[model samples]
Structures are given as structure tokens and as C-alpha cells.
Target: MSGLPERIERGFAAARQIADAVLLEGYVLYPYRASAAKNRLRWQFGVLVPPEYTAQGGEHSHQRTECLMEARDGDRLAVELRFLRVQRRTVEQATAAGFESVERLELADRDLVEWDEGVEERIELLVPVEELAGEGVQRPFRLPGVGETGLVHERDAVVGRVIRRREQVDGLLWLRAEELPGPYRAQRLTVEVENSSAWRPSRHATRDQALPRSLVSAHLLLGLEHGRFLSVTDPPEWARPAVERCRNERTWPVLAGPEGERGVVLSSPIILEDHPRIAPESLGTLYDATEIDEILALRTAALTEEEKREARGTDDRAGAVIDLAESMPPEVLDRLHGAIRGLREATGSTALGRPEQPWWDPGDDPGVDPERDRVLVDGHQVGAGSRVLLRPGRRRTDAQDLFLDGRTGIVEAVLHDLDGSVHLAVTVEDDPGADLWRAQGRFRYFQPDEVTPLDGTAPVEGTAALDGAAPVEGP
Candidate 1:
């Protein structure tokens, strides 16, 4: 394999070429939207690269990104290349856009809903509306009305201009409404139902039935600081009555709080016959009093450093950096951190679409590979190392790198095939430690003698391959 300097040299060469063909081409900046909290307003600086520079994706061929405005109105601001895709636009249009086309990108500051936290803990739940029969209300359809907040249900409710008739032959009518232009043109009006069929006629008794209970529903817009809790239901059927009643009144069932209420307006108002609504039996009405405290207790429980790391979006690098930082002397730590930051910036300059990895130069070593002798996995022999074949990175479907730890004989076999290719079958032992380094995949082949000496000694030539193709795909 080529040495570190060679790999980095090639990577930088490619990045420069891409920069010349794309980044220097320039782009245009346009105002988008501002955050409700007024912390930032989004803007887009569109850059049109030549047809040759477009990434291989559909409409995504053109990249789109959001940037924070430095001032209410300013021409100059830091930008990052966010959306990098190819769009079919004339070169003249692109050149006319008066914005620096170099490094036109920015990082997103939004936190997505924690859907990946766990299946048991949902970020949001929908308590769909349903119809319930009432006195003299044979065709009673609930209308929440546009721009109302919270759920509201009245047993014998009457709403004029109910555009949607309930599909149920004998079930209660369900009507949904969205914001529309009013007669005055400036006011918002309630239009027809969104999807009337989504509401079903359900009874309170069965497990899947929508219970018969008066309810007030609210569609909450949650912000970062606030949270609401929905306790696990002992008997899920308790939710039915609330859902049914919400349908009668046209309110969305919701868990609300001060935090979730931040900078967010409810889609509709919740109006039950009574000012304060009663909890349904399905929600374990009694537990409602204690559920909040229990949730608070869970939140207050002590957590390990690892758990805290997860909360901050730290992965393997975080632990490594922390562990390494803690061991360094105070003065050395500062220097090392600064150096690390610089390294990160330099490496980031050669990322995807950038010319970090350059075209192959025939004059370079072109490297050499030793014939594989024996292959073993978990102690049992698989085949001769020469019999294994591997196609490392650069190719679309090829494996990148391979790593093997000393313990547990993680890599038992390294095989070479008749076609002069190689493969390594690994067998990992007991569960690995959080700080453990498992076997790494290998792209280029090297002699064992060439690698053993370089492990801890002074860095040698071709050490870049030992570091697993850094500049090619640096962190």
C-alpha cells in the first residue's frame, strides 16, 4: 500500500480538482424562513455546478441546505455546502448569483424527534377521532373548526356547514376541518374534513373498540424544553371513550404541558362540555395522579458516564477523546485538543464531492501484496490465505478495511484465491468492551513483517495504509 503522505497527497489533489470544477463556480443566496424563537432565520445559497459535477441522485442531484442569517440583511456570512446535488440550470443563471460559491455549506442545529430512543417510548401518539351515537343527533358530525386549540366534544353538538357526512350507516357523523380563506379574505375559515374515513364507529367494551366517553383533544406542538408523559395503559380500551368524544367535538387527543406549548399554536381548540375533562378508565384514571411523579423519578435516576455520553450524541470518538484527554497533563491537553481541531478541519476539507482522493498516479509505488499462506477462523482452518479474494474500497460493492484484535483470535483466516485476491474470515470472542478495538477490514494487502514493526515505533513510510487509508476517508 502507498504511504500516508502519498495517500494524503492524492486525496488533496482530487479535492483541489473538484473545488476548481465546482466550488469556484459560485452560487446565489436567497432568503428562506426565520425561527419562531427569532434565534435564526433560514436562507439558501444555490450554486450550480457544471453537468459533470452533479452527484448521481434523482432530484437530490441538487443539494439544498439551511443557513442562519448573521444579520437581518447582509451580503456576507459564513456558509457551508449542505445540499450538494446537480440541477439543470444555465451557467449564465449560476454566474449571475452574487454569493461566494466556495464552501457554501452549513450545519443543521435542529434536534429531530428521538424516534430512535426506543419503540416503547414514542415521541408522539395519535388518538384518532371517532363517532358516538347521541340523543336526536342521528347525523351529528363533530367539527373542531380550523385554528382551534385542544379537543372538544359535546354529546348533542350541532355544527352548520358539515361538509363531510359520516360513512357509518348508523354510526355518529365525524367532520374534520382545515384552515381556509374566510368571507373577509383575511380571516381563516374551516373547510371540509381532511380524511373522514379515518374516524371509525367504535364501542367502549372491546379491546380495539373506541370507547363511548366525552373527551377534549388537543394537537400539541412540542419544543425542546418541554415534555409530556403518557403512562403505559393497563387496559388499552380506556382510550376509546375519550377518542369517541373528541370526534363528537372535533378535538385531537393529546398530552400537553408548558414546555410543549413553547412557540407553538395548537391546530384546533379542545372544548369538552365541562371546563376540565375527566380521565377515561382506559388511561388507568387512578394512575394518572402518580404517573407524572414516576416519570420524574425515572428522569432523576443517576446515569453512568456512558449514558450521559449517549445523551450528548457522543459515539466511539467521544469516549476516546474524553479518555485520552483526561490522561493528559493540563497544559498538554490544551495543545493536543488544538492540534486535534486543526487536524479535523484539514481533513474535513477533503470530504465527499471535494477532491481529497485523487486519480491514481502510475509513477507511485503501485504497491505489492504477499501471497496468503494459511487461513483460519476461530482456530479452525478455513483454507489457505492464498485462496481468499477481496476487492477493497474504490469499488461500489467492495469492502473497505478490516481490523483484528489480539484477544479471542478475532481473525482466524486470511485467504487468497486463484485470482490473486484475498479475504479474511473473523471470529470475535466474548462481548467486546466499550473501549475495545475489534478487527478492522483490510483493503490493500501487506506483509506481516512490514506491519509488526510499525505498530508503536516511529512512523515509517507507507504508514498511511497502516492507519487504514486516512486522507481517503478521514474522520
Candidate 2:
């Protein structure tokens, strides 16, 4: 086993927001209540079942995560194992003799029913990288069962009670690292999580019956102290072969945190980009990450008083979503309609495409011809059908521009934005999908200074523009 690190929670906190969204995704569907059919199969992703259940033909019992990390001396690794524990809530009607379990219990203020809820659990395995590199780490852990009761009282007399219980679950975690033979000192790290629960159900047990001994929404968040983790999704050329041999099972690792930061890796059940983020306009989780906030909130707002009452009695989180929809100010809720971000360059010189005219009238922007318009690049006129060399500026370029450093391309159009700035749209000459890109009007954008004319040709006059061209993809 490897040595443990002193600081544990620092790395986990940095990547907590997106991690939480992943944890609660699909927790409950729209119209959150037991009556909704989608609420029955709630825990959908990253479910690790007990080995005994798999022996009788069920879901898989284990998952493995493998990723690459660049490290040096004084580097430490912390593995955060996070999952949800199944909890069964049963409403029992208080009787003169003893409490008898009932399908539904009605109280003065609310109603109650039997439902499944998840309790979050996280086990941290903090180890020094030096010791991990020397030998592997093995740790045994358990997700203890819970039992409790909450009394429902009306006018000082107990009417009913809710009993919550769950079966005990056990598991084992394994970690190891192997050094890659390359100029860059990189380590191939492997972490495996297995469900070793001894509990088993009857031969014909249903999925809900087998879920008590399973790990729901299981995932691993790995953090580094003084090292950097490579983007497995978009690794460099030299590390592609090693990355191909990583052998990640049931989950994919992505570079997490704010844009250029690479100290954390979130190995999730769903595939995601380098840095997945929640939209700024979102208020909070409504349990369905796949749906837009405006639509979900509107649906919640449209529910009847009886529906809202049932939803409020469903769960605490569901009630909170209901409150957000019903209590939000008009200005705050309007923000959910839309938001525009990352405007590259502004467009100028379009009398018809003005701030007052609507393009549907067929009189807007008659002079705006994307293909016929000409822009000055390095003091040379370049437009459609002209060849130019791509010279993406160093400090002004994004990570994607690194690949287009010295590539030559043909000008597809000269686009203008509503912000009163001009941009040039071009297609790479060597790209096999260049024709398809032009046909679809999806061209890469760049500033006038980023390109140089390759051929000496006169500027194009307004014959006609690229027919039905969309806006530039990006700059």
C-alpha cells in the first residue's frame, strides 16, 4: 500500500460543482413523484452491482479507470470514491396496537408514500505518488446500512411514521502506477472499484430488490498535488499510443476544472469534453441535467395545485425545485430564456442589416455579400476564390489554433458581425471535408491580420455571395 497524503479535500473542492451535477443527474424526472414512471428507474448511470447479483445474470459488478499523469518529485495523488446509497422509505399508519406499513399515509398538512432516495457517500484514498510509484495500493471499505424512523404528529397525537432502511454494502479499491518509457516522465495510473457485498437476493429477484446492495452513480475523482494530468481525450502526439492502451472500463476520464487547469481528472460514466460546466443562467439542479432549465421550470410552473402538493411531498429537493419555479421574480426567470457568449468580431457596413429592420421583409442587407465582399489582409485584398496562408497569432489564439499555425486555406467568405467588426471565413485546402464544409456553410473564422494573400488577384465586386451561408463557426 502507498503512503497517505495529509491534505485531502483541497482537490475535491476544486471540481465539486460539475461532480455534483453528475451525481444527481436523472435522480428524479419531471413531475417528481412516485406516480411518474421515470422515477422508478432513477439511478441510471455508473451503477456497480454486487458480484452475487451478476452471478445470476445482472448488471456488471466492477469498473476500472485508467489515465495518464505527468509527475515529478513531491507529487501526491488523492483518489475520491463517490457514490450514492439506496434508501427505502416506507410509510406506516399508526394503529392502536402497533404501527402497520401502509401504501399511503395522509396527514393534516401533507401526504407520504414509499419511495427510493439516495444518500451520498465519498471515501477518500489519499496517497503519496512516490510510494504509489514504488508499489500498488489496496484498501478495503464498506457502505454501512442505515435505519431510522420519523414520527408524523397531528395536534400532539402521532398519526403515522416513516421508516427508512438499507442493507449494508461492502467494496474494495485498488490503485497502481506504471511509468511510461518516454522522454516526458509520465505515469499510467490505474484505479479499480469492485462491489464485494456478500448480500444476495432470491433467484428471481427484480432489479429494485437487488439495488439495495449496489453502488449507485459510482465515479472516481482523482486529484494531484504537484503534478499535471494529461487530457486523455486530446493527448499530444507522443502520448497517443500510451493513451490508446489505457484500458478504461465503463467510464471515460476528462480534464476537469476551469479551462487551462489540468491538476484534476473527473472519471465519469458519461462522456464529456475537457472542461464540462453548468450554464451561468441555471439556478440549480432540477434532477434532469439533459433538459433545459426554462422548459423544465415552465413545466413545473404549469402543474396544478394538487400536482404541486404531491410533488412537494415527494422529496425535499423536489419541493425546492417547485419553490424556485413559483417564487422566482419575473426578471430572474426571464434570464433562463437565452444568453449569448463569446462574440469574436463585430460586423460593419450593412445598411439593410440594421438594428431596426427585420430580415424576413426581404429588404435587409442587400449590399452584404459574404463571397463578394473583400477584406484587407497584410495590405492585400482577399475574398472568395482567393488562396491565403493561415498565421494564427500566438498570444491571441486559442488552444484549437495551435493546429492551424502554418496551414494554407482558401477564402470561403468575408463575414461581418453585429458588433461592427469584420471577420474572414476560410477552409483548409488539405482538409478532406472542405467541400462538405462549404456546402454546409460552416467555415473557420480568423481576423484580417491572421491571413496573407497567396495569389495576386483583383478584389471581387458584388456579383453574388455564397448562397445561404451561416455565421462563422469561431475565430
Candidate 3:
């Protein structure tokens, strides 16, 4: 992939991160029981509810996500949607004999065994696409399946059925918008994929026990022939309300948006990449070959040993992933390191090849010591009174009005949260002159990673007094 442009490569990497986030969003470890506390938060991202939600007395907030794109007249866009499905197994356990029949008395609790039942009937949906005009006139088209498993069949312009197999529980749907038909201009086009399915409630279950009808881990890969890729992290004006509404409800929304528009603009974790479609010259053993292996290693490391066994038993793919992680020889590690070195040399960023290790508490008293713990601002240590620039990106929360990217601010204080996360309180450098003591609200709290220290401003040894006023109680 060195043949690809650097911007395209960055976009691809960002997209991959987003996709990985989506894949593991609601993924619970093996022994996937409904009663598990960790499993309660399933289907949080890209949830498309079926029409049956109306009958079930629940509102379907959204059924599809739309992205605005600019394409040249002759460009073809490729869309890919990948997601996993829930599979269940039922096993019978012998009931303990207390005062039951004499024949039942012979069997003890240790004698009981559980056997794997055949797979359950997989749910099907129709993932149809529509190209909307400027006036919102939708021209529906069936998104046909590309592969040989025959999972998707286009019946008409309005419907495309997705038939997933029991063995192949997950799905990957591919659709391409070929050459535009009949005087259709490609500039400022609207593309929407509907996860159309009817909700089917579980038999012999109460209303409260019903699960979400539709769930999809969708990542749109838009390949433009002649046009440049803009952004997957920004949402259109029309979709902002929906995004905000979902955020207010404390749920992860699909809209990625306008960062400075009132509160923090949240983006969808959905991954997207736009790349040239031409086949690359084959390098016998490129770094890209080990991408999946690396991902598997990371995922396997996250699981406990018991969970690993359960994963191996239920999922062949998971088993294979674990095996790959285990079977990697020292030579492979050396090659991977060499690949990283090459990448760093090409990119001119020393940060590219650094290995990221998970944060662990080595001993007791892991809490942050406000005086001793120095805040890292874009890899450099900075303290109170230090001038810094806000890093560009959407923040989880925009409490202190640090929404503007590359905005400069002056550090007022370093505060530590109850959870041991350190935050820097900064007052915007351009803010209207106000009494620092009285206008503490103007000072925003930001994580150290969100800002970069500016030069010539040495870190102050002690916290600066707000305009020589008395110290405030909290951030």
C-alpha cells in the first residue's frame, strides 16, 4: 500500500480503528448468556429496529444512517456493511432428585451433562439502498449480494433480502453504485442503507424480555473513482438533531458531527475508508498480511483463559484467531518490528512505531497525586500557567468550551477526578476579558492528551492564583 497516497492511508487507518470499535462495541465474551451483567449493553451501535416496534408499543428512532458524499460524474461508489449475529444453544440438565421417583435417585448432580444442540434459525433482513435527490425524492435500488453463498437476492428495485446461514452467523454485504443512469449528476449525493427487518418477539416471553429486532455493525467503504474523500467523522446539518437526541438519552448515536455546534459533537464509531480500487503489485510478504493476526492477538489478550476455552468451543473463527496468536514465531515478531521501522521512516513520525501496552496498576496507592503527577500535553509535560493548543477531534464531553480545534488556552489548574483521571483547567486565550476569580466558568477542564504545549512557556512550579484571587474549591 505504499503506492496509495498518505492521506488515503491515514483515512484507511482511521476507518479501521472505527470499525474495530464497532465490532467490539457490544461484544460479550464466550458463554454468551442473556443473564450475564456484561451482556446487558448489547446492540448499542448502528441499531436499526424493524417496523414491528410500532406494534410492540416502542418507537423506532432510526432505521438507517445517511451520509452525504460528493462524487464525480463517472465515479462508482463501493459500500460494505459487516456485522455479527447472535447465536444461541440450548442444553438440557437433569433435575436434582429430592423426593422424586426412586429411579431419579440414582442420578446425582455430577452425572448431568450438557450437549450442543444444532444452530437456531438465523434472522433475515433486507438491506436496500436509495439515492435521494436534492428535493428528497428517493430512487430505491436493490443492493445485490456479491458472493456465492446466495445470502442476498434482489427481488425488485425496492427490496433486497439478506439470507444469513446458520453456520455463517455473521454477514458482510457489498453493494456498488455503478455508472449513473439518465442525466444523473453525482455531486452532493445522498446515500442511505436501510436495515429493513420485522421484529420477532421470542415465543413464551414477556414484553420486557423482548430483545432488539435489528442490530448491525455497519462500516461503509466508499471508493470514489475521481473525487477525493472528505470525512466520516462529520455529520450533516439535518442529522445533528438526531445525534444530539441520542446523546441526551445516554446512548451512542450513529451521527458524527459539527464539533463546535453548542455541546461536544459526537461521531459514530463506524469505520469508513476511501481508497483506489486498482490491484497493487504483490510484495511477497508485506506488513498488511499480519494485520489480522495482530488484531487477533490483541483480542485474545483481552479474554480470560476460561473465556478463551468457551470461545474456542463455540466459534471456530475465534479458535483460529487464538491459534494464530499462539503460533506466531519470533521471526514474525522481528518482521513486524522491521515493518514498523519502515513505516516510521516513511511517515517521519517517531510515534508511529511505539508499542501500546494496556494500563495496569502495579501496586497499591495508584491514585493520582495532584502535586507530583505531571500532565502530558501532546507527549510533553506541562503544568499550571502553561500555554497549550487544543488537539483537533470530537471530545466525549465538552464541559469547558474547548470545542474549537487548535484553539489556544492558558492552564489555570490541574484537577484530578475521583476515578484517578487528571484534567487540566484552562481559560481560552481569546476569551473576552473577565475577572478570572468570578468567571471560573470560562475555564474548561480537558484531559492532558487533548492539548499540546506551546513553546517559551515553562511549567510553573505551583498553581497560579486566578487573578491573585482566593483559590476555588473545585474545577
Return the top candidate by lDDT: 2
**Per-candidate clash tally:** 67, 5, 2
State the displacement of the C-alpha of residue 177, model 2, in Å, after optimal TM-score superposition: 0.5
Q: Candidates 1 and 3: which is better by TM-score? A: 3
Ranking of all candidate structures by their lDDT, best first: 2, 3, 1
9-120 per-residue lDDT for model 3 (tens digits): 3444444444444444445332332333544445545543444453553534233333333455544343334443333332222234312111111121111112121121
Best by TM-score: 2
Q: Considering TM-score, where higher is better, how would the candidates rank from best to worst?
A: 2, 3, 1
Q: In candidate 3, which residue ranges exceed 4 Å CA deviation? A: 1-41, 51-68, 74-78, 85-187, 200-212, 232-268, 271-308, 331-475
- TM agreement with the true structure for every prediction: 0.16, 0.72, 0.38
- Residue-level lDDT of model 1, residues 1-475, one tens digit each, is 1222332223323332222212211121101011122212111122212122222211011211111111111111111111122111111111244322221112132111111110000012111111111221123223231221111123443211111111111113222212112332111111111112133333333211211111111122211112112211111254333223222123222222222221111222322121122222111111111133223222323334433343222112223333342344445423322222233334343545564643443235233222223322222222222222222234333233333323222333344445644444433335354124333542334322212221132333444345321111110
lDDT per residue for candidate 2 within 1-475, as digits (tens), equals: 1343423355466578889988888888899877887887778898988888886745888899999998768888888889888898998999999799988787654568888878888878777787776558988898678899999888999988999998899998889899999689999999999999987678887778778788888888998877889999899999999999999998889988878888889999888898888898999789875878999989999998777777777777888998989987888889999999866424443576555434344236565777688766544567788798888877663688768978999998887777757788889999999999999999988877777779965433442332322333223
Where does candidate 2 stray beyond 4 Å?
1-10, 55-57, 345-475
Of the two candidates 2 and 3, the one with more favorable TM-score, higher being better, is 2
Worst 10 residues of 1 by lDDT: 113-122
TM-score of 3: 0.38
